[model samples]
Target: MHEIPVPPAEATAAVPRLQRLYEHRHPALSPVLAWGTDQSGVWVAVEPNEGTPLGSILSRGPLTPPAAAAIGAAVLSGVAALHEAGIALGGFGATAVRVTTNGDIRLAGHPAAAVRAAPSQSDLRADVRSCGMAVCAAFGVDPAGAPAPPNISPGLVVTMRSMASGAMGPSADRAQAALREMAAALLSPDREMAAQSELATRAGGRELPPITPFLPEGTVAPKPTAPTPAPYIAPTPRQETPVRSPVSYDAPDRPLQTYPSMPAITFPPTPVPAPAPPPPAPAAPATPAPSVPTWSDAPPRPSAPVEPEARATNPPAPPTWTPMEAPLPAPAEPSKAAEPEAPKPAPTFETAAPASPFATFPPAAPPPAEAPAPSAPPAQQTWTPVEAPVWKPGETVPAEPLGTGVAVVETPPKAPTPAPIPRAPIAAPARRPSVARPPSRRGPLSERPPWLLPAAVAVAIVILLGIFGVIVLANRGGGQVTGGVHTTPTARASTSPAASSPSPSATTKGPLAVPNFGPTSADPISKVQICTTASPCNIPGGSPENGTACDLSSCKIEVAIYFSSVQKSAQVSYTIKFFDRCTGQTTDLPGPSASTPASGYIVSIPTDHWTVSIPNGVKSGAIVAVASKPAVARSEPLLLGADSCA
Candidate 1:
């Protein structure tokens, strides 16, 4: 029972009529068990709700569309129930919707119309709008404003918007029908369900502050239009600069002149360079000549291309050499008198070397006297071939200059020749110095004494004996439930109604039931599942009429009540009561009496799998199972109803 605050003496006058109108059995509108006015407020007694409130849930996050739809469908049903009974619900808010532990819904804040005897059109519409606000709120919308929640499915939004607008049809029945259509739209077969489902997941996920996307108004991010292309502007013409000819002191801009070529460079034969390479036979010589050692300190640069008229020979294969006039012998070690010889103003003995034999451009002009020349390399050092690359047949091997007259040729290596001779036995030298060899690894325990095996066997025998002793001790400590339900993937529900007694014609009574509520599961969250509005109704004797309630006596319940057994012994006080399925009122099953199903030995249920057959006089209702103190956990109400559909 929660205090429903009433304002003044006038407000107190309405409490009696409110209770009279509300305290009766109804499926969706929870009946007020009792009501009384006090200085604090009007306290209305109803069944205790173990489930969370819609207001509390909304605080966590807007519910998913499916959840909102489901919750909305239920809340609307309750609201529709009230409107049908001709009472206008007042002081209602998201808090007025109660969700029970067993997933049952109830419209709780029952009050009279402002005018007492007759409800005005505006009052009915107010109730309608409240229901609409509730559904919207469940869908994560703010009902105070009129912006449609963008996160809501467009298909669902239309109906919810109309309902929230209070013009969703003049009556609660029409609003109920519209909400039903919205629920139906949530089904798989509906053409728009796919899009709605996808939208529901993201509904109201994106929110912004004032005039937020999560309000009654629709949520819609502005569509980003493609940016207009910038107008094309002709590229501005770049300034052109004239090319200046570089001044040259070594090969000048004159007619071609002949000069003696340097000798080809060679490397000393070493293992014939591993099968010495094939010559340049039928091979296209490399375009770039290996750089020759320079006499001048200037960095090497490309000289002008040599005309065919200046070449002594033009081999059909590619040119692999460049002929340049050699430097004036270096004065046999740069004699002091020769060191300062006047710098040439034009061509001289030193010609700018070309990087490739085929280059067409001449080297640029040398820097002026202000620029310092690079120091010459060490005289003692010589360049040597580091490694020889294995050459395949038809591959080129360039011939290069070594000095003024010499040249190097790469000839293919000759196949090794054999020389035959008489054979003779060679004597082996006396055994060299003795070398130690590593010892081989031995198998585990192989190197141990023979007694080691017997010791290991004795240890193993002792361990087995100790384990056997412990098993014997555990059984002696206390009794364990050996008749644990043998659960598989499915529990065979007994849907048959219970019989009064076995008929003479019936030789066997229904197989003695060892109730298996469901499959063996591993949920460490530690929750107790008693029953609820959605629990399956397995009448014990036979299948029942589909749309009608089953006999109250035929229904018995077996709950798959799992709570951590760790605290079972400490949880000493408990209450087990029946909550009427229709009225939402609880009746305590008096303890320790043969008249009732509960036994005195324990006022509380002690184990998982608590079973109870309905007593002689009790009608259809749900069971409220609670284990007090050491753990304050309650079972979802185990419902007794017509069938599983109930």
Candidate 2:
């Protein structure tokens, strides 16, 4: 059971009257279960609370327009009911309302009978203002100081604010009707779903704070304390083992071997080399060329006529001529008149001169015993094998020198009985110099003109551009949605409600539900915006910024209406209305009628606008949209700045 204590000052008069009031049942109230008085004061018990408190729900976060409207509507209904019964709540706020689990609204916080009886506490207009303030509080708006939230409808915002500031006059019915309409439109399935998604995107979510009772001034609630953790205890340390020293030992002894550096070998100085002999002067042709001696230092040739050898049937090649072996020539004795020349060393293969085509040599002789060592010491020398000299045609053979103890032939060799004819050297066929020619151009990937590369690049770029154009055309012609705009390139049949309506048998059971539109989607109507000369509103491309301050002379309103899935391919007609709270007046403007294609589209209304004005003492205003045909629908109040409108 729920319980409330009656103040001591009114306990006597209130206890009896409250009993009679509770005798009957009311939809806006809970039945009084029992009544009595205890040591604290007079008390009344009612049914147990079945739902969350509006205050607790507000603690979690601000409510959406629909949610706040639902609560506000229920609050007013209860207030209106109580007024009919000639009763009034002394104090009404967020805490005084409770929403049941089954979506029913119940009034709690019943006041003392004496308090309700007082005329000062029974003003109905004041109660209506309190309801508006409660709604503003649910939206996290301070009715007296903060601007209205944008999610609310303009009409509803103006109505609520007017009621809150006592500008609604004495009629509470107007405020209640406005809230009911807002709740009906905003509570639709599609609208509710969209609101939930938007709410989820919000950052920094809040949770309800701890619920507590109101305490008298000077009294404070006690705070909770946490338990301390146990003190840390360290583990015992382990004992360390003793380290052992390394063992000492002696290494084996061995004798070391060493050698003195060897002395460099020395040799006797070589004698100065004699200059080469100059070429012999050509002899007179009359003397038969004196039989050109083979050796430069050989004895003069003999003056005898030698027989020539018979030529064979086929003479051998000139380079293949074999020379007959003859005895070596003896060395000439040193001349007494000339300085003695140093003995010449015999030629080895490495030191021998290349054989000439006109030179010849005799067979090698046996090497003689080494001559007795001279009294002077000799230099070290290297010896190598000797090679026989090559024989050539029409050349005389020369002999090698024989050392002492070997025999040498002093007499010149006699010519053979038959001398072979010598053949002249054959001349080779000469090659003509190659003729120069230009470079060949026949190959793969031949050279191209300088402009070929750039021309090919241009062609490729054109092809890419053509492909891009095709893609863009496809998107435009195929009824695709881009960004948040919908495009229809081709004409489609109109399906307005005036042209076609669903039969009764085909009608759906519930109201038309609004669907959640994606970022790239269009809703039936966009949020309203307030405009002035300083910040003129523009649509279809730009959105106007809403503000509380405006220039009255150039003030206007702007909004966009889009065809949703249910309204696609139909002609929709809508109206824009302005509610001035200060003057308690409303003005309606004819909006455009648009034929939406299958792909849907958005249209901003009232291409032309006029000045706006408000009374001197008002502080709030709103804009609202109402659509007829294709199912009647309304939008949440769009609260605008009151600086100029007021």
Candidate 3:
């Protein structure tokens, strides 16, 4: 075991207090480790790993709205729990709460015993005030040094400033109200004014006035007093006795006189002698001799007579002075005193000074109290045997070889075994045969039946006759038939005498006259002009002279002729003939010609009072229009014109 050196006494003394603080539980509060103590007389510590101190997180700054509300709710709930536990945080502020990184907010610090043991309404109010201060601080308000509560409303700004001042009074009330507002602002889902009407009543403080015109009230004053003097006194002998005595001296003149009469003389004694005789007769002879008494003079004494009248008037001077010297009486014989004996025993116990008020004594042992009996251990064994092999004393166990090997072992039998069983078989089936029958019949055959014979005889006769007729017809007039049948010579002669007679002659017309031939005239027509004149012409006089003219003389003779019109009905048949002058060859156009009536043809005449324009790029060739007439001949062709028909 290692020994740790002991800490200094002061450091050691703090450990138990810190431990007690750690163990102490606040309702709804997690136990925190007291890391250290701070100069402000506060316990500095971190919240539990799972818990957060609300104050520390809020002190960093105002939280986001929802976060702030959540934290506020948690703080209020924690406060309520503390209140339920009869605990009140004596000092509540942002510094007194902390937030864990996990976002749990918790109240920190140990509450006062008064709060923890049995909290009062006032104690709770105080806690409210502290909480209010914390909330105000969160809003960046410095609660301390705020204006007097009467001047400032219980609002966030006022409370924060008030808390900054670190005093608890009207400012604390303001802070409390601010806390109520903070609770509403942050925690209340529906922001609302706090339930402060009951708070003033419960707190029993002066009711705060409204924020308008001030109200005043009457009050009374107190009384006053006067002054007095002190008295004086002289010193007294009895009063001076406690002080030490001063030294004194005796007179040396006339040897010390003794007087026993003085009461218990405190000082040494003094002595003196009796008076001398009177001078005689110095009064009677005064006139003559005046004598002064010498130091050794022996003057006689005169006796004075006594008169009865003088006696009443004046008394005579009487008798001589005696010079008796009494030796100083021997000091009144010194009184005898008893000798001192052995001293008495001193006291064993000394009286002590009065006991001091602050002194402490060892505490007395308290009387023994009854203690609970310890419970007995349960009978059921719960101890599990360790799996490790136990080494037995005096047993030499051989070490197993360090390699893998399969171990097989055989042991004695305990019980026995049995046998088996069997089963059964199966089956099969059978068969049969068929039958037959005959074919069907027909109807009765026919005999000569009715007209059969006659028909046959007739057929024979007809055949014979047909053969005879064929032979007769074959022999007749070159196989000709007279009337309906073939005839023999005699039959034919009988059937027609006319066939054998000769026919009469008839009249005949002469051969049909040939139509007259007429001479044709050809006329030149300008290329740009219509042909209007020709001998015996068939052209109309008003027609435009655009094409050449070929005229056959008109005789007005009719002839049977066939005419082939180039156009039949509405369709036109056209043919073009090409003469390639360079080749000196004339050829029919490969494509067919188109034909229309002469009246329908629009011939372009260059001059006839108005010019008829020919189409551009018409090949410089002659064009002919022909019509066929069928009356004169089987096929006749009519000519419209000819163009350089060389």
Off by over 4 Å in 2: 1-24, 35-43, 111-115, 169-171, 182-184, 187-646
TM-score of each: 0.26, 0.28, 0.19
The top-ranked prediction according to lDDT is: 2
Model 3: residues with Cα > 4 Å off, grouped in runs: 1-28, 31-47, 50-62, 65-73, 111-126, 144-185, 188-646
The lDDT ranking, best first, is 2, 1, 3
True lDDT of residue 458, candidate 1: 100
Candidate with better TM-score, 1 vs 3:
1
Write candidate 2's Cα lDDT for 1-646 as tens digits: 4344655655655555566546755665655677765555666767776355667666655655655555676677766555544455644777677766554556776534323343221254567777788767755566665676555556666667776776553234556766777557765665444433333322123321233232222222223244589999998988989765544554455555554678999999999999999656443333221122222222323355534433222212223222222223233333432444334344322223334442245434444557797565553322111222232223432343221112233448887788778999899989887998988777767877899999999999999999999999985676433442122111224566333222223233322212111122224444333344454454332344233243333344443343343333465555655544334334555554534333223333322232344333334445555665343455544455443331
lDDT of each: 0.47, 0.48, 0.34
Model 3, span 349-467: residue lDDT tens: 33444433422553334445569899665443211111112322222223222111222223358566554445454444343344444433444553337888899999999999999
Estimate candidate 3's RMSD in Å: 71.0
lDDT (0-100) at residue 642 of candidate 3? 28
Clash count list over all predictions = 31, 13, 49
Number of the top TM-score candidate: 2
Q: Any idea what lDDT model 1 has?
A: 0.47
